[model samples]
Target chain A: MVSVAFKKNLKEKYGIEFNNEDLLERAFTHSSYANEHHGKHNYEKLEFLGDAVLELAISDYLYRNYPKLNEGQLTRMRSNIVRTEGFSEFAKEVGFQNEIYLGNGEEKSGARNRKTLLEDVFEAFNGALFLDQGMSAVQRFLKQTVYPLIDEGDFDASRDYKTELQEKLQINGAIDIKYEVIAEDESVPTFTVQLLVNNQKVATGTGRNKKAAEQQAAAKALKK
Target chain B: MVSVAFKKNLKEKYGIEFNNEDLLERAFTHSSYANEHHGKHNYEKLEFLGDAVLELAISDYLYRNYPKLNEGQLTRMRSNIVRTEGFSEFAKEVGFQNEIYLGNGEEKSGARNRKTLLEDVFEAFNGALFLDQGMSAVQRFLKQTVYPLIDEGDFDASRDYKTELQEKLQINGAIDIKYEVIAEDESVPTFTVQLLVNNQKVATGTGRNKKAAEQQAAAKALKK
Candidate 1:
């Protein structure tokens, strides 16, 4: 059973209050725990629901807020936000390591601090919140947590523009993709790269290195 | 541009009326068309949004309607609904092939009826509807189109229970998966199969043939 004090603590710390405390409890209850305690609900079903809920929330936010971002960029940004490590970090910040219930065996095996478990719990928590209070409440809660991280550009560093460009161009059928270094400034040590799709010059960029220049050109092509 | 008569026809045929005609037009405008016509917007961004919108709607429907279904079943069911062929069927029913805008070359190449394009158009239409109204509006549209098909078991035939069970059990780590014919009744022309996950007899089934019995056993294990 989840304590009244724990519920109060959630409200105090995270601005979240659940009317049905059982869902909140279920959100933190791992399948291992449920297997050990017969007939108890686990977080798996809730995690499934939460995954979709989070997708829509993130998609809507990115679509509206990032008008300049293309579909590929928006997709990449959403993936970064919802990835295992990112959600695990959110769970850690919420102290789920202390709150989560697991089987004695699983707990002994360090499941409490496991990244995948923490990520599942975070999603399950959001799923519970959505069921209890609806989408707007979940959005508000995200505003307090994930939205700030998004605003801080926490999800931007992992984009591989070159790969994205290749995928987009190849979606219809296989086509020739080339990134050619056109010129180099010896004094400044800068390389200029041109991106060609089927030998048609699409975009150009200059950077301190060849890879960076190629990536920059690909990024430009994606924007085009 | 989307004509007033086309809008009226949509309202009469499918109970859909768009407040923003421009968004409706954009939803049907292919990238090829947009590229051919300078400054014209395409359905790519809207298709991205619509894809997430559809995912959440199908997920919510499955989660609420299938109380006995586990997360694995729910995911598989959702995939069947949102797959290219399924969405393309919906697009065909909506007469999108006639309404869609394409470039000269694309139209000449018969892209208007292309399965993937139709699926993208179906998603883009829903996305535009979501932006024009809200999630409720999109839900209402699906009630008229996709939801009935789901209720009719249109998405049920493609289930591979064996693959699903394997995926679920293997998510934690790889384990030995075996299906053995435990018994055979030649006179009755039936076989009994037992599914063993890591040497544990999890579930059993009987069917007219070995393959059928194995699938049934796998399905039973998944339900467990």
Candidate 2:
């Protein structure tokens, strides 16, 4: 059951007051809970609508905000943010962990803490908001939350590859990795970088800049 | 260059008049054309934004109009419509093929008829419309075009599997294909169907109804 305190907190924190409180409740209700509760509506439909809304909002934000970035770059950045892991992080930040209603079995299994469930609830929340308000209100909610994160370069895909590779490779122990400029073409201003893991050639990447080439190399290496 | 007649036609046909004609022109301008013409902007960015807009619009339409459908069914139907082949058909219907500006090379290669290009142009056009007017206008346009097609069950995923399977298996000549009820559980009200091709069982599926079971069986057979 949704608490009055939770409703008050939403109204105060985000200036959101739901006319249809049931919709809000539906957003937080897991399928497991619905199954146990005799065909009560779950968050799945809301999640579906919310997913689309998020995609469009993010795409619009990236398109309007990042003027210099090409479509491909903007696309990569949007993809980085509009994913399960990314949404889970946002859900966590919004304190959704405690808000979600789970079945006794799911609660026993600690399903509330699961990233996929968190992601779904996040989307479901947005969908409910969209239904109650509209796209502008949803955009306002995102402005308070997601837009700032984007401004902080939290979901920058360009910087992500190299950082992800380093984090992943370093998890085992301290490991030596090098990205060396193997070739430079002044005509096209292209730089080719060779990536080495423990002094062994792993991947080579070519791009318009050194950072881009290194990121590409890291991306290729990660695939391996 | 975008023709005045094109603008007039849009106004006459769809009652759509762009405040920024350049944006409309940009939507129709191909990247290849932009490269040849000294980087004078292209449709890629618009296409990216348009893709999202279309997704959300379709999602909203499906959610509101098809209340009985589960999230999974709605998702599958959306996927069927929001694909390259599907968009290309819509683009052709909207007469986008002639409106697109391609490079000399692309034009010589007969790229105007290419499904990929048509799809891109379709997205670009929607994106441009979104930028010019907004979601409501795009919804109106889709109501005039796409919504009708959807009403006709043109992209129905449930019926699609059986039809697609039959079409694929019967490309050369008429082939004997049959759907047999293998099992029925009255307690659970479950129907199990076996898909047979050339008098040999290819796949089996279970569902709530015989039609659903047949579709599932066909889907499995198609996978094989």
**How many residue pairs clash in all the candidates, one count each?**
0, 0
Worst lDDT 10-window in candidate 1 chain B: B151-160
Model 2 C-alpha lDDT per residue in residues B108-159, reported as the tens digit of each score = 9999999899888888999999999999999999997788768766667777
Q: Interface RMSD for every prediction, one decimal? A: 0.8, 0.4
Residue B82 lDDT, candidate 1, scale 0-100 = 78
Q: Per-prediction RMSD in angstroms?
A: 13.6, 12.2
Give every collision pair in model 1: none
DockQ, candidate no. 2: 0.71
TM-score of chain B of each: 0.69, 0.73
- lDDT of each residue in B1-224, candidate 1, tens digit only: 66666677689977788888889999999999999999999999999899989998888888888888888878788887777376876676667778898999999999988989999999999999989988888888898778876775556536668888899989999899999999987544567999998999999988655656777898899887
CA lDDT, every prediction? 0.83, 0.86
